[model samples]
Target: MARPFLYRCPITGNNVQGLTSDDAAAEGEKSRLEMVQCLACGGFHLVDPAKGPLPPVDDK
Candidate 1:
């Protein structure tokens, strides 16, 4: 099973939520898989790209 991870907003330092593999692939103009804007600062980040590649799994 994958583990849960946490990230902080670059602009506000607020706790950001983690992303799942599905979330990464579904990212579009309005959606993203990385550090989303924090309600406090509205800053965004790319989260952990170097963590490693995602495992193979069927789309939900």
Candidate 2:
């Protein structure tokens, strides 16, 4: 089985799962700054993988 693409909701700080790669791809197709409605926060946020799973922590 393939791992689902997970994204972090910056508003809620929750992990949201994309059931399939196609879903993630569709989001990316829109644009890098495409906004996705967060199921957790119920608000729109950018679908940014850079801020997704295992993102680096800013010590500052």
Candidate 3:
């Protein structure tokens, strides 16, 4: 199976996977900023590959 594309939630620093390039492209085209709600932190954040992979932050 193909590995899923992953990104980090800028707000909570949680790892978010299962997002495909097509998904990002569609979102990017729709808005100036592609924001996604973090399932871990429940906060909205931007996904940018340029930021690199970020380690998950502890909420506590």
Candidate 4:
């Protein structure tokens, strides 16, 4: 089952949410690389799930 992951876009600096593989979800606490497609920049980046998925931004 896929799980949610989060990362910051290097190009856009947007806190984006993404899904991870079943294996990755099982090891979410571990340091592993997850490639996230940035919603703000439309670029691909590799980020560690351990470091982020920062708290929900207050857009208001």
Give lDDT: candidate 4, residue 60. Answer: 88
Candidate 2 has an lDDT of 0.58
- Model 3, 1-60: lDDT tens per residue? 333446776655557763324433454454323466567777766765434456666579
Better of 1 and 3 by TM-score: 3
lDDT of 2 by residue, 26-56 (tens): 5546444445667787887666543455354
Instruction: Report the C-alpha displacement of residue 55, candidate 2, in angstroms.
Output: 1.8
| Per-candidate local distance difference test | 0.50, 0.58, 0.56, 0.71
User: Number of backbone collisions per candidate, in order?
Assistant: 0, 0, 0, 0
Candidate order by lDDT, decreasing, is 4, 2, 3, 1
After superposition on all C-alphas, the RMSD of every candidate to the true structure, in Å, is: 12.5, 5.6, 6.5, 5.1
Q: Rank the candidates by TM-score, best first.
A: 4, 2, 3, 1
TM-score, prediction 3 = 0.41
Give the poorly placed runs of model 2, Cα more than 4 Å off. Answer: 1-4, 18-31, 49-60
Question: Highest TM-score among the candidates is held by which one?
Answer: 4
lDDT of 1 by residue, 1-60 (tens): 434556655555456555445343434444345544445566555766335333444447
lDDT of model 2 at position 37: 66
The lowest-lDDT stretch of 10 consecutive residues in candidate 3 is 18-27
Q: Alpha carbon lDDT of residue 16, candidate 1?
A: 51
List candidate 1 stretches off by more than 4 Å: 1-4, 22-43, 49-60
Which regions of candidate 4 fall more than 4 Å away from where they truly are?
Answer: 24-30, 54-60
